[model samples]
Target: MNITKTDVLWNYAATFFKISSSVLLLPIILHKLPSEDVGIWSVFSSIAALVFLIDFGFNSSFSRNVTYVFSGVNSLLTNGHDTSAQSGGVNYSLLKGLLSSMRWFYSRVSLTLFLLLLTLGTFYISRLLNEYHGNKTNVYIAWGLFIAINTYNLYTLYYDALLEGKGLIRVSKQITILGHLAYLLVSTVAIYLGFGLIALVLAQLISIIIIRTISQRKFFNADIIYQLQNCEGDDKKDVLKAIYPNAVKYGITSLGGFMIQKSSIFIGSLYLSLSAIASFGITKQMMDITVSIANIAVATFLPQIANLRIGGNYDRIKAICIRGVVIANLIFITGAATIIFLGTPILHLIKSNTNLNQQVLLVVAFSSLIGLNSGISGAIISTKNHIPFVKPSILSGVATILLLIVFFKFTNLGLLGMAMAPGLIDLCYQGWKWPLVVIKELNIKFSDFKMVIMKTDKPA
Candidate 1:
């Protein structure tokens, strides 16, 4: 159950390369596009986030299943060598063959579902555009862009999952770096040619498609394809069925989470100015970047943790959970401090004329705080398969919407207050609820959880 330092470095490098490339492009995008165009882009992104909900958490669920199968195969080989003289026993071969077949069948079914959902989503978006935007050509263009980007994203997930299964994270990192470079090159060219926002979308899609194709060739190869094609029947059902619950949990959580995150923009468009939405959107993007980094610690550990649990290394799993929480907090505190002190300067760099309400800063700061705090508990809950807590997460979204209404209606606190309310609610929920869940449901000692916050261990 030992994790090499090289593994951690490879994982971090991958995440950092991806984040850096996107960060580098942000300024170019903002500088070239108008504020209104940025707002429109935000709306498009918000809609795409909703499409993620339809993913039904298949990405994570599939990764978990893939990891389990790979780990199980390794375990069988080890046992076979130890007990059966290095040649696998009949039962070992049977299990290996069964798992291989099962993975193939599940992969086909997953691909089918992915395509079906994408079609349904396109139809839904088309209908929504008709009712809301009313035949605007840009809406159609936006929808096309959405489909292309999401299709590439779907394939990227496939390649990424395969890499995780093979534990070829260094290769994954290289693919990510190449993809980002492609995106930047395409976007720069598109901007130079006056291609507008569509250029940005196309750049992203093309880059992802290229990376996915290359990575698939490099890692998955012919033997994997042969195994998948030959797979069939009840074995496949078992793996798919095992993953279904987690997928549904993540899918529903994504739906509610997306609604909460996007409700403010929706409300702003209806009741506030487009400029206000633009300002808020910019701030949200900053927060998202920070959250994504904080999330890396948790994400890097998930496959390993799942493998550990499958291997019955519960003590190691518990230690990992504690370390993850502590690392998340450290990231959160540092990020929050930077935002509190430097938020205005950062915004000024992006748009010199951009004047933000002080309240907006507070809201953003508070929300970032809540986000960081909740990240610890959320990671544990997801990795441990304690998915019932997702109901509370859904409620957090509902609370965000209701609070926005009340804050805007009854308080004269303006946009900042409206924004800050969601953060406050999230903080309270994590502070109050996470403890009970960890102690009562997870059965981890409260003292151990507390020690995680106070201790400073490097994350595995």
Candidate 2:
């Protein structure tokens, strides 16, 4: 239940490393690889991202449940957390069962994803190869490595759940920094040596192995191993059942999120030129960085939030949430202002292919700020283990997509249309509703919020 400034800083470092590795690699990639090869690699990156959604919502579900078990909850529930029957100590048997179920689930899911990649993914790659004018042999080798990395990464994904669930934020962030550092170093050197696309995928594969290995060692030290080994007759099937409901909700929510956040790029490609899409994409990417940095404190304190929820410490929860939201907004506002004023000039200085549109950036910034607020409010509500926002999220996503189509066909807004579509749709519902939901659910008055914002009370 003890979160620290150090924990938050580590999380920020991890996020920076993870995001910057790709940013730093981009210039190298464009410089060394052919444009065709770079395009193909971009496709591979997209596919890798899509493949990761195969994890659905299980990671968060598993992590939350792990936190619950670690927080002294004796049993798992299908829809809500088990706060009533407290064990007042970690439940090794429950942990063992949950771990068993996680392994059983991920093993099957990863295998299924691999099969899908081998078959359907290969078919799609073949179509791309028809148009590809690169070194075919190297591309094939890269594709093989890409599939292996993704499949193996998915298989070992439970390591993430275990680490974050145990509130090992510092160690988890350390592992992230190390893994991404390996990725950046290996890929940079190999590309400079003319390894081409293979270098990138190979770097990623090594990074994943390093991360999973360290995570395994960190989470399963001698004491934990001994405790799990001594546990017996745990019902993994029951554990899976208990996790299934919320996990599926989380997975669907993820899909909706992808649709809301990413559909613009796909839809924009149809109506706008590549240059326009690229500009919009750059602006969106900057906004994404803003969002990630803004969420650092909230993400770092999530396990503690869940722990507080289990203890029924509503006041402390309110204080923590209020602080998290306040910090998030302050960060976002600063980031957005900097991007608005400085983003395009920097892109111009780099002699980039495209520039960020300040108008688009400003609109997306507003939308993203709203999204961040709603997201934090939703996260607070989720600590009770009830996913009330799923339907609204999905509906908002659908509405955004539909509105984008209308904008593309019925108006000449182009990239501006793309930025405004999600923002306008969100502003109508999710932007305001979720925060209101949190206020009502937590029964927070203006005075209480003011007190928390003024730092009159500290969250445990």
Candidate 3:
């Protein structure tokens, strides 16, 4: 399969939709729902993210290994780069086995996620909602729908692995755009109809269904169908064994990363008022959107980066590092300033249920930028297939959570603590560490980085 220009273009399109859905959905949700209910919605979204821990990084790890199979590697490697000699053959049987492994894994995980979210997840939400005076019926209905959507999403997650592994990013992004449009349209209508929180999750259900169905049809073309049909035997266990080592590592790393990113929301809900959570969550969401917008190019090129690493193209990888950092810094710094200066006004214009203080958003901005830079470094390093920084990433999260607990409990910071915890810990290690590792790995000198920073290339 050949990569096309649209591969990158459609990725931007998909990001537009994702960010657009959030931006568009928010004004409506904040407008229609009560502040307390909005807080519950925030918690709901956070829990949805948490419940995905059940997938436990299988989808991403599977996708990366699937790329290896397609790259013509015969066996899964633990570390180091694959020699270029291994390229040029597509291992359809291995992919078939991987697909079988995916289905087998998802089946149990999906069931478990459903049961857990329906029980434990629901319990968590109920605890949050105990102080709510909003619409209980709608919240309950939305929770049920959220659970279902996640279950189905987990079950069919291989559609993503297949598309990404085959490097069909453009096609996948197009389908995603269509689904998100539907989500936006339906969700907007639902909110206008006063459906409240249920409206958001209901729209998501529709979008996921549309997106997954289209992906399944688009990916299983004639050649792939022929290969899968000819393929026999359930090699799920073999596939699991092949991917589990790094996959488990990635899971732990991801757990730490998720906690660092989300622990504020989770713990803040416990320590802060519902209204405070709403403000803090909304502010954090804005920061996330900024990072996502800044990250478009590098994120789209991840599979290609993997391919480059396997080919031992250190020069190209270094170039990507320079461009990614430059773009991320420029975008983040500009966006951060704009938001710091205008965020309150923008929130006001939309009649938002919550708003951000300049100081608070500023803390989040710089901290998030540092974390984003680390993320850029991590992305480049992981392309080399050895996760040397996994421990630091996990430790960073532990540190961030502990900081959050201490700040909220012992200080007068309150929502300010929620905003500062992740960023503060990130600055301590994650922000600077990963970039230094990348520099060391590539044998880059400090002067070269200085020149690279001073130089400007094409717009990322």
The lDDT leader among the candidates is 2
- Displacement of residue 213 (Cα, Å) in model 2 is 0.8
lDDT of 1 by residue, 28-117 (tens): 667776666566666666655655565567665555555555554322221111122222212333334434543454455446545754
Candidate 3 residue spans exceeding 4 A from truth: 1-5, 81-87, 445-460
lDDT of 1: 0.62
Q: In terms of lDDT, which candidate is stronger, 1 or 2?
A: 2
Q: Local distance difference test, per candidate?
A: 0.62, 0.83, 0.80
List the candidates' TM-scores in order: 0.79, 0.91, 0.94
- For model 1, the superposed segments whose C-alpha errors exceed 4 Å read 1-3, 73-142, 222-235, 349-355, 408-414, 428-431, 439-460
Relative to the true structure, candidate 1 reaches a TM of 0.79
Which pairs of residues have clashing backbones in candidate 3? none
lDDT of 2 by residue, 145-248 (tens): 99899999999999999999999999999999999999999999999999899999999999999999999999999999999889873699999899888888
Name the lDDT value of residue 143 in candidate 1.
Answer: 58
Select the stronger candidate by lDDT from 2 and 3. 2
Highest TM-score model number: 3
